[model samples]
Target chain A: MNDRNRIPIIITIMVILLIMVIGFTSQQRERLTPVEKWIGDFFMPFQRIVSQGYYGVEDQIRTLIRSSEIKQENEMLKEELHHYQSELIEAKLNREELMELKNLQQTLNSIDRSGFSEPITANVIANNSGNWFQMFTVDAGERKGVGVNSVVIGSGGLIGRVYETGNTWAKVISIIDNSSSVSFRVLRDGDLQGIVSGSVDNELSGYLFDPDAEIIVGDQLITSGIGLYPRGILIGGITDISTSADQLLQNIEVEPAVNFNRMNKVMIINPKIYEE
Target chain B: MRRLFLGSLFFFSMIIESTFLSYLPFPSLVPNTTMILVICFALYYEEKNGAIIGFTAGLIKDMIVGRVVGISALTFMLIGFLVGYYNRKVFVENATTPFVLTAASTILHESIAFVAVFLMGYPIHVTMALNRIYLYQTIYNALVAVPIYFIMNQILHSHFLKKSY
Candidate 1:
């Protein structure tokens, strides 16, 4: 290309870049536009194929890593199995009795039952190519009854909440993001309530309602049914606790139960009208 | 017709980057394929075409990512233009140009993205972005450019191969 042609091209490229920058900057950052949604829906099939491919590769890697450990675990499990065989009958009878007692308790505190409902399983399709485990896309969307604000959980516990929905896909904001906060309470002491918030380092820290609350290390935390997340979902275990002399709240730190690095499949809670 | 093919290639690369790339053990280690392609095309073709391809690819990426729409587009266009323009000045048909150009473009592209993302009101850690995105991706993308350059060169030169008489 000659100088004359090059000049025009450079000018055109700069003009387009400027326009796009201005246009995009002015748009809302929180919501996807119609065109963006259509583009995402268009790529849904490709997303599924890639998602499967990703999981297949991850499974192979996990298998390779666990190959040696599996042998030891197998030996351990077999020994434990023989021991449990003798106790299985007694445990079954105890479970039956416990079930009867639980039924009586449920009848009494039926209204205060933990806020948990069945979930809709979804495949994790894609993630933002960044070190921060903040955002990811799931294969279920409005078409499959997935809506924004639906709680998402993996095998371990609370992962995040669905923040954006397209026709065939929904974007999940993981609990590890800087913008995420969840209302939680101590599993051992239900009255000890607090709000756990995510930081840039993918750790959770928060403050308890009472500065005088005696929080101990290893205290398991669960959702308090205060926000979009349902009640009784395991958030994590408290790792550290501290309190300043003049502060009104105790500083608490929690290590999340779900490992964001290994997350592949998640279950999204469908819209259910819980009795308030 | 060739431009159309190149456009399709960029589009497919974006799809793979967004979907398949996420599954890699450390996804941040995966080279930015589209950015490498942009640099390769700019060096092989001309700066003008490179800028256009980069812009289109960036637009598609932004749309699929559902983030700020212009950040990638602007970053890609500028990187494409600078790489292409300097590629013409250097006019070196040697083996080192693609690697060097790819590295420079990757750093430029990622820096532009970091600035644009920050401007869009998203909190960014400067040192982390520089190390993870700029440095890591530049090295990875430069390495990726080697094979991609050879493959694209072969495809572009296929018509030039005469019959074995």
Candidate 2:
């Protein structure tokens, strides 16, 4: 073909390509299949290498600047460490009491523990940087019994759920992701169900459908013993609420107790497999 | 070949921006670097190539971040096409011009994104969105513009620009 004719043809091809991209992405949103999982896994090593390199440099610079300060702080921390040790014991006691209370509630409610499986621990290897959502890739994969729909929990509470899982790695769709949803209940109240959705601003907030539901600002939100997550695990606390004029339901905002920004380790809870 | 290279570069930049850059404690409410570099490339390259690269980069972003499809693609394509057309008309071959072009393009790109989100039936606070656009992110992108453009330009020149049309 002549050069002038070729230009128009190229433009046509580009337009066609653009349409194809839009169509493909729409399908991707609905289902991320095995192929997509493979691609994500294929790219995992590269992502890890780049993140490690960047983090190594940053850590080096930080260590250099903070070495002296760290030493002085260490002595002061040692003094405070004694008090912290005592507080740790009290905290452990409180935690145990909370767990016992949770167990009692489970027994009262006749909650099924058969589906609860041992959790797999994984290290966060990378994080999403530019996007408003908070996401991380973990080292555990299919080999380690990590699969899609697995629940990830950090120190404070639920962090996210696994969206994609591969043979050697998995990508977590954080609770901070706009598409993520968690079924939760008010721990202080009995049998109130609500859905916790993520915002574009990387904040975990949700709406309570029941206007009469007894929910307060500091009330703890826990998984509702339904859907992909297990019951009795802490999610976060209700921070703000706005009641509509009609007052059918309240617009509730939750502040996730989990410090996702500083999260390094996570426990991936796999659903139990039963044999007939 | 040029298109492929530019597309890959933009993809890589987006990956780097989302993974590594997000962690740094910058003096801004929201820090972003991928769109800025994509805008710079769009300003320098041909219009069609610019749009293609922008679209690809935006697709990768949506895939990773889980936004409704076509939002970033639509926004970046518009930014790239306009910037490319502007570069064709006005000869911007200096250091300062690229920086200025990036700042202007970043603002336009971000506004388009804001509008796109708003139009998608999502609840958006105009004041909060405006604050993010004008003060925090705009300044952050402007400050990072020079260095990012410098690196991107070097890579483009070496890998793709050398093969002249």
Tell me, by TM-score, which candidate is best.
1
Off by over 4 Å in 1: A1-31, A57-68, A71-118, A131-133, A205-212, A240-253, A270-276, B1-4, B27-29, B160-165
Fnat, one value per model: 0.43, 0.21
lDDT of each residue in A1-276, candidate 1, tens digit only: 777476656657676766666565443344567877898898877877877887898789878999989899999999999999879988999989977887888898885443445578998887764433367888898888877778899999999988778888988888877668999999999999999988545678888998888789999999998877878999999999988678777998899999876677899985454434
> Candidate 2: which stretches are off by over 4 Å?
A1-20, A27-39, A52-113, A129-134, A141-143, A207-216, A241-243, A271-276, B1-12, B26-34, B39-45, B51-82, B107-123, B133-135, B151-165
Model 1 compared with the native: what TM-score?
A: 0.78
Give the best candidate by lDDT: 1
User: Considering just chain B, what TM-score does every model have?
Assistant: 0.85, 0.80
Q: What lDDT does model 1 reach? A: 0.76
| lDDT (Cα, tens digit) per residue for candidate 2, span A232-255 | 789898899888788887878889
TM-score, prediction 2: 0.71
TM-score of chain A of each: 0.74, 0.70
